[model samples]
Target: MSQPLSVPESHPRPALIVVMGVSGSGKSTVGAALAKAISRPFIDGDDLHPKSNVEKMSRGQPLTDEDRFPWLAIIRSTAERVCAEQAHSGEVKEGDRPAAVVVCSSLKKIYRDILRGQHAASTKMPAEEDTSEKHPSGAHLPASPALQTYFVFLDGTENLLMDRMSARKGHFMKASMLKSQLATLERPGEGEDGVARIDIDATPEEVEGAVRKAVKDMVGM
Candidate 1:
């Protein structure tokens, strides 16, 4: 299900917490912990990747833009579906739409833009469509925009992250491709909206605590 797309103007937006980084940066680790802390659902973005993409990664190949766009769309829709279901269940406050924390690489600016509901060349899809078509006479128009997405970047040096990836087991993304991802990564720019970075030197418990505090501070969850 698609998110409502709009909420009351007076209401604070529902948070879409995206934990992003290249492989082996503890994205799923911290995202799951944060989702539990906030009583929201957690989604592993790799699970949303297409079979072909997964296969390519397993073969130690990198995904190109053409390969990533559709997968990114799935991630956005799945997260929205979770948010819509949470809102429909009435478990959350009227306007305090519940959040969904997701782990994604979101390597490029365009990739992150897709998650943010922004359009780029050839990236146009449902995110650019109007919700008015779903309602009579556009009555449900423009009250507000909820499910605002915020990105938490897991920052670490290539050497450190590479060492961690090499020691991991059973993941499709090979350690050899870490440099490819790091090269592609455009670390959320200074002008980027709702972007924050992590302190990788901290312990696991400390990292989770820091993520929770950052999400709350950023989205008031």
Candidate 2:
């Protein structure tokens, strides 16, 4: 049998890490780096958004709460799917799980709560729809598999973020929307669990190094 690779720490695995921030905060870069550091798979939350949401964002319009719940639901489902897939992968041994990382803006507390598999105020969710899954016959199925969800909130100054956004080429999100995104962001609270607030006011290599270390420490592994 092949030997297991060694890292500085060992996380419990089955952890869904949401690398979150507004536009140009380097969610994708940092998320990918963290996944590499952990030897896990990474998914970009932007790819989970519905086509309508993509079009809206491309037009430089900010999404309303109505436009976000469906997207967040997709993220939540994908998180569980990623962990399940990794758990059954060839390299994973019995009784061991793997972590999954994804990039998401998750600008509001309600959004973050939804990602954590917690129900938020009804007004925030789509009308008459909850996070539960249903069968083809509309029967209520069991809830999703339990996985530890964590957030790596990338915090930075508006000017710094704006500069990064402007330098990007052909990204769906526009630099003009950065102001609104900053306005929409809700920083993690002191009481929030499993969160790592990362400051991104540094170079990519520097920020990525911080992200890797922060995740390692936050996992306490």
Candidate 3:
């Protein structure tokens, strides 16, 4: 195992992590592993998607932005609540700590902006479909916490993802929709913030190790 990254004393607040990528990219598995290593709560982004959306995907339909809007709202609200509540009370539930490790595809930059708004309302980040000329920070939410937000992008070739989807069983999403997902996928670029993009070329263990190391290094854990 690689050594954990050491956090700087001046860093503020626990990280709000989003394990993101297209379906079959192992967001849940890797996110859970990262949460375990960091000792934080893991909130699966899949759980936040509405039943209707799941049904549509299962039926091999690509979701329109309209279909994703409400689901994204729920994600943003939950994240906001998590950060704001902890910042207010400084106490975690039961034996848990204050940090949250959330896993969501967060495909579009606009989707991420919506989540950022939840962290601080003063930053009026654009809505998912609101891909106007304005940047994410252009709209500010002051109420949002200043805590660091980390995003992990699980990446692989289309063939690899398709093969994994075919091998997996009983998932709410169907293999038929894999192509649609691939078509809709938006890979992370260098300009995105708090993003740790991992290319999955080796074993799952290796991918998990890279993610763990990225988080530790990014957050100075």
Model 3 per-residue lDDT tens digits across residues 134-195: 21321122333444567888888888887787788777657666776777777767777788
TM-score preference between candidates 1 and 3, better one: 1
Estimated TM-score per prediction?
A: 0.80, 0.77, 0.70
The collision pairs in model 1 are none
- Candidate RMSDs in order: 5.8, 7.2, 9.4
lDDT of each residue in 5-54, candidate 1, tens digit only: 44344345566789999888899889888888888899888776656677
Candidate 3 regions exceeding 4 Å error are 1-11, 50-62, 84-97, 118-147
Best by TM-score: 1
- The clash tally of candidate 3 reads 15
TM-score, structure 3 vs. true:
0.70
Q: Model 2 clash tally?
A: 0
Residue 218 lDDT (model 1)? 82
- What is the Cα-based TM-score of model 1? 0.80
